[model samples]
Target: MTVDYSLPKPELGAPVRVSPFIRFCRWGLLFAGIAYGMKRQRTLEQRETAHRANLRAQKVIWDEEQKKIATQRTREQLLQLAKDVNVPIPADFDTQYPPA
Candidate 1:
């Protein structure tokens, strides 16, 4: 029988054979990932800040609406009082509540 002539393959690639361009691309991707994460964090912080500001604005608006409703209720009660006493109610009766 004729002897086999194929050579045995090596277990691993040669050392220091990694291309410099591929290495640079790997490092560039790593830095890009870090920058992207920081940008996402900043965006989240901005959104939270805006949400807090909106909530504060809404609270102010709610307080003003409540004040108006309370004033109207107070005026209605004073008008009822005047009716019970058979007297004319003052136009500025709303300014007086829990009269002292």
Candidate 2:
């Protein structure tokens, strides 16, 4: 038995063209992907906005609570907490709660 180590040669044929249906499918897939990406981006942006607004609302509530506590009692700790949380204490704070 003789063994042949020769490689097969490449063959060239007529050029092939894409079918109309396949081209249409390709464009359809591209548009679908773009639409999905836009939808996902909008969803994520809306979620982020809601999250920020929620955080702002929580901070406002916390600030108000601190100020309320400070107003109820002219204690040093509560007053400090309100000042730090609300920033530039309200003008009435000085007149209403004199330092001890």
Q: Give the alpha-carbon lDDT of every model.
A: 0.86, 0.85
lDDT tens digits, residue span 2-94, model 1:
999999986985777679999999999999999999999999999999999999999999999898788778767777888999998766664
Model 1 Cα displacement at 3 (Å)? 40
TM-score of 2: 0.47
TM-score: which candidate is best? Answer: 2
TM-score of each: 0.44, 0.47
What TM-score does candidate 1 reach? 0.44
Per-residue lDDT of 1-100 in model 2, one digit per residue for the tens? 9999998988989999999999999999999999999999999999999999999999999999888777667656657797789866777865767763
Candidate 2: clashing pairs of residues: none
